[model samples]
Target: MNTYSDLRLNLFCQSLLQSVGMNKENSLVVADSLIKANLEGVDSHGISRLPIYAKRFGDNRINIKPNIQMTKKSSSVLMVDGDNGLGHVVSYQAILNGIEMAKQNGVTAIAVKNSNHFGTASYFCQLACEQNLACIVLTNSPPGIAPWGGKDAFFGTNPIAFGFPTGNDQPVIIDLSTSVVARGKIILAAKQGNHIPDGWALDRDGHPTNDAEEALKGSLLPLGGAKGSALALAVEILTGLLTGAAFGPNVKNIYDNEESGKANVGHFFILMDIEKFMNLNTFFESIINLLNEMKEVPKIPGIDEIRYPGERRKRDKERRLQEGIQLPPSVEEELIKLAGQYNVEFPIPIPPLKANSIVSN
Candidate 1:
């Protein structure tokens, strides 16, 4: 496979992301985060979503340069108005603000309203660890998952993420959707012209289906059976319900169509000062110990060695930076269109798979 260069890919991605509606700086941040997911083999959040975001943004559904200013601020809490801005851009700055606030207080809790979809939650949570803070992200998206035993969809993908700092061991960042698969999965399947495995989702009639188009018309199964459903609702309450944005059945996508008209999605971010809880160095050591213990465990019958939550991503980032990123045929086509729309020229496409870099999950 031919190697792709990160410089070219990043430039291409950023240009398109910005042309759609994101401010140049925010678009670059979004592009970098999306590319990080791709490098880590999480293609669903990568460039594939660009075209949809562009369409939504161009239509004035998602804001380009959101003022993300705080509406309420306290010693350890903040309330923000996203002003219908880009979720990624708003949430990224929100997390950074939370970290800074935590420095003055023992912890900081920030709730946001009027935001759109932010990519992987891990990206924002990891930002806290980069600055020696404990980070947690609560985000609610359009309803797509069913409450256990109930037929109708009642929960957003409703994701929660956690990040902790560590000394020698890598920072622990666990980002997950309460559903078996995120709603983004369906969007991605649509992009690749692929059909998902059955049992991943159910139709509007509550019957299992594999068609991405049909699943988009239906509800997704909760992860871990019922427990994930419970968590999904809890996250929705924090992110959407309480934040005054649409929640559960009311939330709609600003990305897809007129379907989710005027989406004002809400998100919550929290950052805890590690030093306030314990010595920063000591906290790192404890985290490192925990991760080290997990690493020593023998692989299960069919499992490989136990890896830390963000370890693979960190390694992938290092390798991909050297080897470059890849663009699939569909994504490449969209990027070409983006180039035309922005009146920009990009280098010839390169194959995604390469020597040091495996395609991101």
Candidate 2:
């Protein structure tokens, strides 16, 4: 395991990305998104993905310099073409436009196409939250989950996220995948030579398996059986069909070297200005009252406290910032190789603490 401060890690990532033909501004945005995911304990979407991204860039699967364009469909609707750019760069630009339109027209809907994988959806939501706006984010990915009662993979492990500003500095953010677990978790396990728990996925022959590699060749189970499959369908339509991007199994998988083409991932974002409906303070007070009531009523055995959505993430970010972000040996080794390949300086790891040095006084 290796630990690193966020600033040093960000610089290392930026250097590596720039070496791969990405511009400085876009590299900074991508690195910030990856590091923030690690800080919030979502390691699946963190810097562990750098190797795959670099490979795609080298293969010409993702454009190094994309021409992102936006069109105004109406007073509250906008369309974006990423021109095969990184999802982080495309989505960040789209959300900024959406927020501005919402401030003028109460709400805005933005559809993005021809993009690659974006990090966690909550990151974009946090941007809207900073402006006291409510937002819903949806995105389609490469196929990983299967439809209800099906043996083959069909729908992507599409995710949906919602964000709302509150009286406190922390906003209410809910982000989740329609699958029983995120497919990235299985990919990370496979990379680390670890076994996954049962019920997360099935083998290629439709049998349950704990092996991460086999699970990758198979289909992931839905979050709640048929219900989750249904939600995934809705996201597929909104992000893929409605946005004119690839749908269902047609979305190209980023990890498959044999699949030669763009990912064509799609995203949908809706931003709503709170002041349009009512006073922002009144809405904050109502949300606070509701949260307090819920906390006052919750206590099960072995439970310490009741935390609202995004609260634990906020706490994790705080602790990680104070200490440091730890990376697994597998991820660190891959990063080191990339550093050498790109002729970039790698960040020095924080030394592990010695047990004998601890003195309890």
Q: Write the per-residue lDDT of candidate 1 for residues 1-361, one digit (tens) a residue.
A: 2346666666777877765656688878888888777777677887677777777777777777777777546688888888888788888778777777899887888998888888888888777887888888999988788899976787888888998878543688898899998788787787778999877899889899999988888889999989999999889889886777888878776655557466778898888888898888787777778878988988779987889788888887777766666666777778678778878676554454444544432
- RMSD (Å) of each candidate, 1 decimal: 2.8, 2.9
Span of 10 residues, lowest total lDDT, candidate 1: 352-361
TM-score of each: 0.92, 0.97
What does the lDDT read for residue 147 in candidate 1? 91
Tens-digit per-residue lDDT, 164-262, candidate 2: 999677899999999999999999999999999989998888889999999999999999999999999999999999999999999999899799889
lDDT of 1: 0.79
Lowest lDDT sum, 10 consecutive residues, model 2, at: 352-361
TM-score of 1: 0.92
Q: Native-vs-model 2 lDDT?
A: 0.92
lDDT of 2 at 165: 93
Clashes of each: 3, 0
Q: Report the Cα lDDT for residue 199, model 1.
A: 76
After TM-score superposition, what is the CA distance of residue 149 in candidate 1 from its true location, in Å? 1.6
